[model samples]
Target chain A: MWGGGADMADPALRPIQRDWLSKTLAGLVLGAILALACSGLFARLNTAMPLGVRGQLAMWMVPPVWLGVLGGVYFFSSGVRAWLWLGAASAFVTGVFYLL
Target chain B: MRSEFVRIYKAVHTWTGIVAGMALFIAFYAGALTVFKEPLAAWASPPVAGRMVPLADTPKLIAGVLAADPATARDFTIHMGDAEHVPGRMGWQVRDTDADDHDESSVRHYVGTLDATGQARIEASHPSQLASFIDVLHRVVGLPVDSDPNRWVMGLVAALYALALISGVVVLLPSLVKDFFALRLGKNLKRMWLDAHNVVGIVSLPFHLVMALTAVVFAYHDGIYIVQDKFVHDGKWGTAFQRQQPAAAAPGRDPASMLPPLELIARAQAFAPGFEPTALQYQQVTGPRAVVRVWGKDAAAVSPRARGGFAALDPYTGKVINSDFLPGRQSTPNLFVSSFFALHMAAFGGTAVQWMYFLLGLAGAWLFYSGNLLWVESRRRKRPRDGGEVPAQRRDVRLMAAATVGVCLGCVCGISLTIVGAKWAYALVGDANAWLLPVYYTTFFGCIVWAFLQGAAKAAVHLLWLAVMAALAIPLTSGLAAVAPGLNMWVNTSLSSLGVDITACVGAAALGWMARATARRVRQGGADSVWSEGPQPCLQGGVPGVGVQAK
Candidate 1:
């Protein structure tokens, strides 16, 4: 996970002061998108099953999946890439569901 | 850790823990007490002979109630009296007309109790809101959920909490196996705190995971259900669930001919062995097909969710209609969902489990408290032992210390005081519910201001004493009332009442002990520490420890 900085370890934890506002906001937005997309993905997979089965599995699965995606976003080295990737995934899913 | 992942995770763990610690402390502490919600409720409202109706006499009482509130024939309950839920009474549920048919809602409730001469008397009943208040405090202590949009504020916190859990485990991975049980009581307070905090955080990881994830679902269940109903189900929830019907009774059977209370309990036992019906609810009493819901607990069932297993029966024919939620008869999906509810509510395994949860809850609260302490300690700059000044950068620690002491202790005291207030509330106010907020907020804010003004070390001893006094009042007021000539003799007769008194006494004793321990720590601890009252590091600035760097 160490990139470019040979001397230092875990550059991510160095407490970057500059552009913190942007990073925080961006992380929040991207995390939310990824969470929603993951939930929709679970829902889509369960579509062939009965409604009760779908509901049950969704209840058991969705929250953790959503939370996992949310936590996963903070791992990225760059906030811009995190936002861009999550935003793109969200759009792709939204379009797929919209068409269906 | 040698890798950057450790450092990054360390930051993540630190930030998430700091952000969620305060709310989680309230949640865990209140949640721990909520395990005994029924006992607490009973303690709040002691039973009187007038309120308790014998099971054999309930039929006559129901007849009388039907005469008084004929609407009750449609839907009512003969609240089976017990030790935990004192004062057996009857309830009439009024439903909202506009809500969706399956989107169940009971708009208003009126309760009936028998008078001395066997007539039914009804009142606008208010179940003491103290247990519920504590439960809500456990859920959304900082932001009031009622005012929050989408009601997802708790969900967001839960997400952060999950992150905290993950990152915390990550940071501890280096020493996870080696230092799991090491409780070093050396001079290094930070090491001791870290060890203690990590042990608790790791040991209770399963419980915390269940709570955090379930809390999110609970907070966002409405939205999730909507997605499932509209998008997933495509508006066929009723069809998908395959609602079952009774085999015995036909339509238009008279509810008046329904099996009596005693028989209902007997039949419920037949359906599920050892199913003890605590409450008999008659639903749709006005409609053509009225049903009786025999709600109670089954000793054999594993999950401990409140309300236990129930079988909806045809009141006229005593035929079991819906026992899907019954202990022995749950579907695979039902069992799965039931397990979650059971774990979330600690509804399974009875009193012993409840006690375990209560202790773990207290431990969880301690973990958060120590997390904050570690944060404050991390920033404490080292200085020479020769009375030399350290940097003034200790103000953040000072403020955080004050806030941590103030808000956390304030919640603890506020709950205890409110329980004490229950002894006097109904007698004092026309609107008793109105008094609860004022009583709690007054103590909570007062403690906060006091902490800031007097500092955390000074306020800790005082607040602990206040907490002890407040908790003692719960048992004392009731115990002493027994000696009074005019006060009711019910508390003297009930074990639940005595249990509440005894538990409160124990809690008060614990608080008293904590106060003494804290006072000693304040008096004798290190000089450069925020907890220390020895001497302010003679830094350049007037500030105690905000920014003065260590030499």
Candidate 2:
């Protein structure tokens, strides 16, 4: 029924349709790890700013950005790429955050 | 014409929407009702509330509460129930479970008003926590009662919810211009549902964004605050807004030395001009650290909390002591933070915005519900209605259909029926508020079981009846109260109270209409669906026992 002339009913695409379990694990784990570390790092970067505005801004910015990162992961060109990109990005950010 | 990224985003939208749609539905539905929390609370409170002791005699009532219980002398408040709606109320803490900790939600409060003889009598009897109950349901989904784990659960769900919003927008972007308002209502049911989902979602994107971001902040504010404290300020942020202690009360200094509540409100005006006093909360009224936080809002000032500007006054001299976050007096950064909060809470805008947010909330609920329906529809088995062998639907789709009907309708019927119980069944229980929890949980799980036993079409009709019955009970209970015996008229004499009845009637009418439409869909609709008369009724006529009739 897809207008693309290739439906998900094709045997080649059935496996992708059934890949929900792996996607869930990747989304939950990679998504959360990146979200927390990135929010913490942003708040840290803003410590030099006057007043407590940086902290307050962190609260508003962190969640949306986290979800953006998650969207980036899932919207990658391939499922394998989605997993690899999310894993590498999450590790790099978290490792750098601790190192800095 | 869609790109690979758009295709991937479509999958992301589908998955995240499936994950978060149900919880989001409950949150949005209850959250809509919570916009008018004060009015709902006023409507549900007993008539005794309307008799609040006059502002002229508030000090006398205060003195009485202090004298009746020495512990109450620690902290008491004069609740400024507007003379028109919720008059005659004062509150005091009976016992400090956590000593000197004033702001914890767990503290037991004793609220009452003065009697005819002008005596401060503690009215221990309360009608129902209808408003607060609904607000609490919006915050936490009634599993573990707002513990940290629950907050984390909701917070993570919010993260997923945010992902859903992002992906949904991405998928809709390429066709955003031409198909923005295109609602093709003809043969394609999926197209129509998708359009409705997309239209509602796109229109309310800002509102949903604020909700998602704010939910994350609210849920993990403690952790975020800690991160700020340790990393940002080297643990010095704890003292950022700390108020300097007042001169210690001399031994034998009577608390009667403190200024009256009116004088405190007047002094608060010196800090925030045109401050409309709503409530005055006094902490440590008799102790050396006694402070009276006068909560009033200057309508001219935009505040984040629904409550107006706050001024912590020196109770003894009626002098303004703290004004850092007070509306019209807050610092720029503080004001920005407060403005963000006010945006989410809709505290800045008046009643019109409140109504707008209410409609937005209901629309949000519809978006989630329809999302779930679209998911189930996507996987429904295809077959002819007249005859031939039909395959079973996907287990996941069947389960989602049951859950979509069960959890969402369960929440609606639960809240409605509990409020009905609050109105009519209070006399039967030891505590009406306590009684509603059971009423909600029972109905919630009961609907889920029923949905599984009977499939989508039949379950939808029955559960809708339950929803209509529960909703109708609200106005019905109030209407019967006026004419019935043993139930003294608890309706407030104000038009606001009557508006609640009207709203309930409107809600019931909507549910009734929904029920009728669902029944119509079961008969003579497309039989190539689970919602239609498919197998267990694929034969020429219908199912043996069940009521599925095929043409």
Largest TM-score belongs to which candidate?
Answer: 1
Candidate 2 C-alpha lDDT tens digits along B146-170? 5677777778777778888888898
**A-chain TM-score in candidate 1?**
0.57
Interface RMSD of 1: 3.6
lDDT (CA) per prediction:
0.71, 0.72
RMSD of each: 5.3, 6.0
Report the lDDT of model 1 for residue B500: 71
> Which pairs of residues collide in candidate 2?
B52-B88, B297-B308, B297-B309, B304-B342
Residue B59, model 1: lDDT of: 72
- Native contacts matched by each model: 0.37, 0.48
Per residue, candidate 1 scores C-alpha lDDT tens digits across B22-76 of: 8788888888988878777777764443446777877777777777877777778
Off by over 4 Å in 2: A1-54, A75-100, B49-51, B82-88, B94-107, B112-127, B142-144, B246-253, B298-301, B384-392, B533-551
Residue-pair clashes per prediction, in order, are 21, 4
User: What value of lDDT does candidate 2 attain over all alpha carbons?
Assistant: 0.72
